[model samples]
Target: MATLFLGLNANAARMDMVDVSNNNGYMSAAEYVSMRNEFGVKAVTVKISEGGTYKDPYAASNIANVQAAGLYVNGYHFARYATKAQAIAEADFAGQTAKAAGLPVGAVLATDVESQEANNQSKATNDRNNAAFMKEIQKFGYRADVYTSGSWANNKMTIKGKTGWIAAYPYVVSGKNWYSSNHAWQWSSTAKFRISYGGFDVSQLNSDYYTAGQKSKVKPTNKAAVKANNQKANKNTSKLVASAKWVKETKTYTLKTAVKLHTGASTSSSVITTLPAGTTVKTDQVIIQGGYRWARQPRFNGYGYLATGPASNTLEYVKSGATHTYYTVKYGDSWWTIAQRNGLSMTTLASQNGKSIYTTIYPGQRLVVR
Candidate 1:
């Protein structure tokens, strides 16, 4: 079938496209759902591994949520291995996972490859590997497509007969463009739309442009199935929370206390409660406040008491001798200034301090003034 170019303006149709690669930081299942609902994402592409090695966490839940939303869903795998056997194995893994999850009809299986130096024999080998992978997926009775950059398609990969999902962001290349002959063209990287879950800015691409025969086969029964699917999905989501890593360590305190307290400006003023010595708070919950923003705590619920007037900026101090009188440097503390005030020399002071003449000292840094 000939390739189709779904123009950028056509994105008003409310299609949400999600890139589920491992590179895009970790997102919890709840976060994924929130993002989907917030951004109105209509489709999610779960990224499986290249060599059929690893699957992401909450994969089942993510798929379930997408299915419940009555949106199109698909899978893509990074093609790290350029050999036919490796590609086939990766395809097998994707096919099994997709079939198991009962992905909706008209969904696609995609291969994502980019410009990278690899042990693959040649560009032809990469092409052969992708073709082999697609063939494996076809064995399981599903359609497969290739996703590649425009430059890569023109310079490296060749797609003559196979359906290609071209990534030609920024602008639609000319009709004779490398990716123009693709089954679907990713025209814009920033396409805005709304979904039932929420609204989001998605990329402009022909997500799944079905041929006449394929389009006819898929009946629009998704709307009717949404409510029932969502009920089951909510149950699955609850199960996901149980498996989630939500220890107290993850809770963060924005404000010191739920209510703000006033502090009197005096040395004996008990403005803030000191944490017990050796009391260890979770790394995730405790955030170090500094600078101008330190005056107020973060705005959140259930935080403890507020801290007043920069509680001992330094956390630890080394006790030296009977007393440790740390002195701050005054203005005009040059070699001449030191000699006139403390009777020290330019060379002697520089050598004793292990500093050059050009060293720029700060206001509060302690030095051996005596």
Candidate 2:
């Protein structure tokens, strides 16, 4: 029930933690520092290995840089095991690979088990194989957890007593609210970060994975100390700086459906007014809270949070006020797609917006298309 701010996951897209198609990418020391200072990142989970073979080339550099930046660095292995033997083999490889990549022992090293082969197996088989993998991973002196989608975590496998990192993105997240209880909740794959040109995968952790892991002089050999540490993590109600960012440029949106504007991000908050359909509202910021995407509209007294639509997208509640005037970027939007939607080339659109085609566009950014 407590809210604990946590860090994010990084793969080929290191500093920004953005997901790119290619398997290799870089994140500089400065970028890691920005992530820690600007975003309240306490730790980062980097991809280390896959199956029994592939080692992420960026893993060593990422671990070294994050540690040098004064943040905990964890690792995860992508699993491709259908049998117990294969799972054990993969775990051995992951353990060695993580060590080679500079992943410190005792830091969390989760096994990513969302592959098609694992999903296709029966629930019992999947659980057995995953348990085998996790047990093997722990022998290398590292904490282990299973990372999988919410559905797979429940139906395809069981995480009854074991630590888990479940992935499930809802329309709105009030704070640490998820479908299934777990050690960590990977709430968004397209989470927008200020320094990033694209969306990044972000998670909320509810464990001592980073906090206790960092401070402890040695691994807690006492079971009581371990239990107490986990309890403390769960009871930690430390307030986190709201990740919502205010945009510099404002844009007008004409409502297609009537919507209640609230005083706060959650719907349960006091309602300020119910703007009728076709109402044109100018908004400067977008917030993801209480399971909805809220547009912050400037009211006479102050600002009101208007529920534009589900967190997934806002196209259903409102549309652009006029043609070729301005457009606010949304998650999953790219320069080319925005240009195509507005009937212009990327170069033309960028030129109109006082940017270049190479410029990075992010959600809540306003672009001129005229």
Instruction: Give all candidates' CA lDDT scores.
Output: 0.45, 0.67
The best candidate by TM-score is: 2
lDDT of 1: 0.45
Off by over 4 Å in 1: 1-16, 21-42, 100-106, 115-121, 171-180, 187-202, 207-370
List model 2 lDDT by residue over 228-254, tens digit each.
433433342344344555444377999
RMSD of 2: 15.1
Please name the candidate that would achieve the greatest lDDT relative to the true structure. 2
RMSD of each: 27.0, 15.1
- Over the stretch 1-370, how does candidate 1's per-residue lDDT look in tens digits? 1111222222222223555543332334554454345443445666654546666543555566555654456766666556788788888887776666554445677777652322224778887888898888877666677876654564456766446765543222222233434555444333322111212223333324423132312222333233332232233222111111212223222222222221322222353544442332222222212210012222244233222212111111111123323346666555546533544334334544667556776655555533
Cα displacement (angstroms), candidate 1, residue 43, comes to: 3.3
